[model samples]
Target chain A: MNFFACENLSAGYGRKEVLKNITLSFEKGRIASVIGPNGSGKSTLLKCMGRLLKPSAGCVYLDGRSISSMTDSAIARSVGILPQSPSAPGDIPVHCLVAYGRNPHKKALSSFTKEDRETVEWAMHATGLQDKRFLRLGQLSGGERQRAWIAMALAQRPQILLLDEPTTYLDIHHQFEVLELLEKLNTSCGLTVVMVMHDLNLASKFSGRLIAMKDGQVLLDGCAEEVLTEENIFDIFRVKSRIVDMDGSRAAMYMGVA
Target chain B: MREITDSDAKRRLMTGAAGLMLLAAGFVVSVITGTVDISVGDMARIFTGVQTDGMYHVLMNIRLPRIITGAFVGVNLALSGAILQAVLKNPLADPGIVGVTAGAGLFAMAVMILLPSFTHLVPPAAFIGAFVTSLVIYFLAYDGGAHPLRLILAGVALAAFLGAFMSSLTVLYSDRVQGTVNWMAGSLSGKSWIHVKMILPYTLLGLFGAGIGARYLNILMLGDDVARGLGLSVERVKFMLTMLAALLAASAVSVAGLLGFVGLIVPHITRLIIGSDNRFLIPFSAVFGGIIVIFADTAARVVFAPYELPVGVVMAFVGAPFFLYLLSRSSRS
Candidate 1:
């Protein structure tokens, strides 16, 4: 059975169709990233996969069950989505933020059980935020806060994690830090990650598979080598680009508008 | 964020204790410092059920019920404001400021005057009025989201509109406007056990509803998209909370008229003292809200000796400035 898949999904906001008849499937224990220019419907596609937005046409199937068939919390138990710049009240501490990730697993008014506490601690530890657990979100640096949010998503103990532009606001070092953490989680915990990424080089380096989209349709989908060709880059982004191989890893270096 | 930390839990417990203590102290102050003073010894006798004829009438019948009514009014309005703030993501949202109380007041006035025989239905009528007013204000302010300025502006306009109708009613029925003058002033004067009975059930409901809804309010602070991503039915939760707030404000308005500032500033102060974890924040606001109103009513009773001021007047004097300060501070942020 497909782990998570959106089959011929078409969704939009109030007559503005952003995603049109898009079909994609993600396998278990793999990292795939979607990359495209602004308004290319990358974020919309990610939202559909997470069932944040309902499709006007077709449906999303999570492990052979239609998404519309399950309750919201049920979907959340198997899949966790972190939208762009997820925030909590700043006064809440690090550990507390991570605990919110378990929102799907627990009842609304249920007291925190030992299992919940253990999972929260594990999520904080996995994100390397055990030291900062007591510190409030406002006290943490940008990178640390991002990890805290990531830890919260991990607290759900979801099999599939979806993120929209997870590294948008961070600097390069922080970007790599976040991506490396995701790579570690994917390999170590067998977590499936599907994200919308803006950085081409980072996407190619960390993700095993990359899907490039243009005008709400996938232009290319394959490994870094197969998809990051100079011709494909020029056609997709409409820019002159030269592929540079450094240490057996390819980087698409854009010169200017094509 | 998640579960409790020891220090956090301890701090919350201590704050809760402090709040309850203040509320008890407020009751004593409200009971004793009235126009006719009841001494500690008299209070002891009154509580012990040895009814001393001289102080018993003033203390048991008049003073005690008014205090109870004022206390419940404080809690209901404060919780109303707290829920609205979190649900709408607008710090300035309050029953009085948002025209909810005016709606309640208007409906209440209509029931009391036009349908005098149906006076028993004032609370429920006010509830429907409050609910509809909030819904109207929400749509007016809700251009994509409930922006703070937009909400306050809509509320101010609606309140002014409702205020005009109230004045016209006062003009048309000049003979029977005495009872409503107190409602317009928004005080707990001349209240009895009947007033207490009016708002008591709502206070219990508010407490229970608040307990269940606090967790969702915290989740909603993460913004709607994030909240929904976690499998929360965001719209449903918000609607429930807004209705609860409207009911609370309606209960208070039906009993004590249009008390302002208790809703706006009480929760704001409580949040400042403790953090915005609504589990603690709601109860804390309730207690502190009680304390503020009780003391304000006490001040109203004693400020000019025999000539008493309405608690709403006192609240506006203090609350308006505090509101302006908050606006300035928030804008800077």
Candidate 2:
């Protein structure tokens, strides 16, 4: 039973249908990545599931309930989203940025509670940012800032965390650092992690399941071994590929020509 | 939560206290010193229901009302600028620059110049004008999304377009434009108790609105997608804040006659000291707003004694240089 699912979801920007009648579901405690070339509706599908964009013709269910029927606060409490380029004031300290994640759990005019501070501290500790809580965003390195953002998402303590291109601007080492952090969170805290990634090899290596899209539709879905086949790579990316087996996973390497 | 000593919070509170003290000092200085210097003792006696000197009429009827009205107008303008800056996600967004206050200026000018018989309708008319102009800018700037640059451009265009109407009114009714010159230049010369009463409701509303809206403003600076991820109703908050800021600017323009730069400079200065948090920024801006205007208005009254200058002129002269100096310093830092 797919509790967190998108049922025949179709969505798009004005005059352009980007996500065509695609159904996708993510199981609890599993790490999944949606991979596709530019404009293949990878980010669009993630947005629909996260409820940032309302589906035009279908429903997204969060734990057996239609997200459309749920209020934004209700969904926010269950799922946290980190956008492609999330920015805060450069002058704001890391801890303040993380503290804002408690907004969903706050009441109007109420002071930050004891529980809120503890959650923020836990999130900081989890992301190894407790030492740099006083550091401003402008003062942090690229990987530190990205980790700070992840710490903010983690502060919400949501069951499922959605990220869109969370490593787009990071170096390779930092990219591995973020994915490894997510992997750790999945195992340790049972966070169902879903992300939209452009790096096919990284997506396949980091995630247990890979969902591939092309032309606004999901064309392949399975373990990386099943989804990274040569035929599937060409169908989704219009590129020939050789699937290489790593130590315990697979990485699809692009070949010059078919 | 047992509130612990967060040094940041404590320092912020101290900054707020300092702003309040400055405002209090400003009020006393603004009230007692003039062509007729009502001593501090005499001023206290009048408040305590004691027999007072001849300056009592001038104190109650002239200085107190002007000071109060100026204080609230300052509050209105500064709060409006702070809100607009956050709402537009631009540091430079101000009521005068973004065209919100110019809309109020146009309508208030119409009432004063053309509809001279209905002079009392100026304040409400200004609010209507500001509301309509903000709506126009909102729609014109919004295309699939409202970028900060587009919104600023739309505001500039509409402000200029509305400015043309104001100039035409002045030229067409040149014969009746006698007494409004000081007002057009943004003065508080003849502002009385009635003016104070006229701007009170909007000032209170703005303070209340800014208080509640501060939370949303901080989240909004996170961008629409991130703010939405936090469960905020982004579109609704944006529209509400735009309207609130417009009301604030309109209220000030209704009384002070298109005072410019207070919103832009005051909030930016306050942010340098208070950080980007809106909760403290709003009240701090209000206090500093009152301080700057009161001091500037006093200087306008006293420096060129016996001949009053428009407070707007004084503000422009002082604000422009100070703002640039701060800008240079902040960029280096």
Candidate 3:
């Protein structure tokens, strides 16, 4: 079943609409990556899905219910979103940061329950941050800090997690490490993952499904082999690219400008 | 995998206990040391109901009320600063930055000048001015939401505007200049039990509200978008917290006449010692703030002897340099 979907969505910063009549949906446990050039509204679309941005038109639904009608805590329990370049206050330890994700599960005056502790531990362990849990976020490298943020989101224990440009500013190894972590979470825990990816090759390599957007519309949406075709790459990104199959995954190697 | 551990909680509790002790010491010192120099023996005799004529008058009528007022004002201002810093997510954000102090000062001055017959209404009037100024800054800073930088900018702008108007009033009413200047310099001079009574309800209400909202403040420090993703009603929480902070600052201003630096410095020092968890930060800041103000007020009363400097003057002399030092240290780090 489609656990999440947006219908006839339009959104923008001001008067200029960046997303126009965009409709999309995702099945319960699938991993979907949104790939597009800089100005193609990929982040905007993710923001709309995360309820960070209210759409100018149309509604986002979770489990066939309009998300706008749900309480903030209810939506948070079902959907977790990490925007690009997420930041915490100065020198906050990883454990403390991760513990914040349990905010929705706890009451205003209540202490952390046994279940809250267990969930935070599980989140920290899942992100391979158990060893670094006590370290301040500022003390970690770029990749470790990213994992710390991911752990924070995981502590929310949402049915679906959405990340925008999660791997930006990371070295290639750290980038793959983050994607692999997400893939593991997707397969092992049945967590639905949606992320915006600028690297077409990595998006195709890791994501089970890819949606290519251009000019505020979906140019192509399918498996990597279907969506990362030479013509689609040229059409969407205005870049000439060759698609090579490495193992079973398709890798888009860009040649030059189209 | 890692828990908060027993030691961390114990450490925080110990810190709080120590802070309370220091506050007690400061309160005692404030009551004891003045231009007339009452001894500990005199204070003990007075408390034990000996009621020596001169000492009784001095302790009950003058010193005790000032000390109580100073302590409460410190707590109010410091807690307000802590809340503002957390809600705005800017360390530099304070009651002074957001025009609460200036607004209160302006209204209080206007009352002193224009409505001298209704001098009793000054505290409430100052509160009204403070709330209105904060609301103006909140709305002006808001495009769709109140960004920290915009709030700070709007506050600075409004504070300057209010300051100009206050200066004009002071200049025009030269005959009233002495009283107005003392208040503008943030004096706690000649306060009676009536002044303490005036601010008590507001201080209690503001402190209670701030204590309840402390947890939400922790979430707010994580940034607005993250707080929303964590299921916090960001805008509503921000609005309520800002209003609470304004109430705290306004109450302090009304009683103490705009004691500066206690709010800004106390929170930073508390955060440094106990860490940034608002639950602990708020209470610790309250105690430490009380300590600082009690000491500062005592120094103000005794330092120049008969002349009597305003506690605000003493605070500025100390706090301005400390603020600059903190700014440089933070930038370097």
Candidate 4:
């Protein structure tokens, strides 16, 4: 069975539907990237998948169970989400904020256990945030702050990690750094990694599978090399581009779209 | 940085220790000096199962009630202020500033004037008024969500309106105006064990609720979108917070009659020391609020000798500049 599946899903804000009739399934332990334009509902779809937003029509299933019927804490234990903008109150330290991710795992009046502390430490280590653990989120650079939020999500010890524009404000080096960390997390920990990315190059480079979306519908879904063809790019993104094999690999690079 | 950390720990220890010592001192001073001043030796003797004529009567009846009332009002105002600040997501949001106190006071006075026999009706009536006003402010501020600017604007307008209503009510009942005026000024004079007993239950209940609710308040300070993203039912939490805040204010209004800035200033100071962890902030504010009120009450009585200034007036004198300073600092930040 697919780890996460959306069947005939429809979702949106109050009245307007942002995503319509979307059907997709994520395999266990695979890095999947959804790429689209500004208002293509990529972020919205991710939110619905994470059970942050209620699906207006149809249902989302996680590991054969319907997501809609699941309790928040139950879903939280299985799935961790890093929002586009994860905020902290005042100058809250990274360690303290990361400890909050363990909230779902905590029973009422339960203090942090040795295992919980170890997980937090491991998360911090994985995200290269060991040195900056005591620093406040507000004090860190944008990239470091993003990593802190990721570390927090990691501390949930989730089977699936969903990210919304995980590399929005990072420099190229930091962007690669974050994506590489996600890659390691996918390979080493066998996490079901899914994210929405705007940069097609980064999406192609990092994600094993790519799903292209347009106007609230999935236009193409396949392996990164197959779906990211010049003709498919033109059809979905409404642009012209030349697809070239980069470094003798099947992964296609778009020179430009005009 | 190391030196600063040490100093910070030392400063906190010293400050908390000083506060504790001063609290003890304040209690002793409150016991020793009152309407009829009792000597320390005689006071000691009275405590040690030796009953003296004037000292025993004075300590048991007058001084004890006054100090207890002062302490009760102090803690009530502080906890209410802290909760209000957290709820409104503004350091400046207090019972007095938002007109909850005026609304509560107005309802209580209306009862006092129209139905003098319903002495037990005051706290509940005040609580209802405060709760209703907070709900009104919350609804007025609710657009897609309760925006801070809108909430504050509504609070300001409502406070002004309620203040006008309370003043008008006082003028309307000019025959019993002194009693109304004294109550409005936040005096702890002439209070008995009954008044002490009356506020204790509500204060205890309100503080207990604030204690549990403080964790959510810490989450709320992170902003609504993030809070919602974390699976905290945002609107429900806000409603719960506002109600908790109202309870704090209403219970306080019953005791101190619209004591301002205890909710505003004390919590801000506590936040500066302990950070915004509600677990520490709420209790610390309660302690500081109690101390400030006791200290203020002491000054209120002794400052003008026999002619006692209202503790509320004394608090305003101390709290107003601090309020302005904080206002400017927050705007700048």
Measured by TM-score, the strongest candidate is 3
- lDDT, model 3, position A83: 88
lDDT-best of 1 and 3: 3
Candidate 2 stretches with Cα past 4 Å from truth are B1-10, B140-150, B322-333
Superposition error at A112 for model 1 (Å):
1.2
**Mind listing the fnat for each candidate?**
0.70, 0.62, 0.55, 0.12
Computed on C-alphas against the true complex, the DockQ of each candidate is 0.56, 0.53, 0.56, 0.29
lDDT of 2 by residue, B1-333 (tens): 113226667878898888889888998999898999888888898888694567888899999999999888899999999999998887877886556677777888888887889977877787788778887888899875666788888988998899899889879888988856766778888789999998899889999999999998999999888888888878778888888988888778878886878999999989988788898889899889989999989998999999999998899898789778867886897
lDDT tens digits by residue: candidate 4, A132-210? 8777677888888888888877888889989999998789988988899999999999999999998887888888899
Error of 4 at B267 (Å): 1.1
lDDT of each: 0.86, 0.86, 0.88, 0.79
Cα lDDT, model 4, residue A210 = 92
Residue pairs in clash, model 4: B81-B263
Give model 2's DockQ, 2 decimals. 0.53
Candidate 3: stretches off by over 4 Å: B1-14
Candidate with the larger lDDT of 2 and 4: 2
Candidates' TM-scores?
0.93, 0.94, 0.96, 0.88
Scored by lDDT, model 2 comes in at 0.86
Q: What is the lDDT of residue B12 in candidate 3?
A: 90
Candidate 3 DockQ score?
A: 0.56
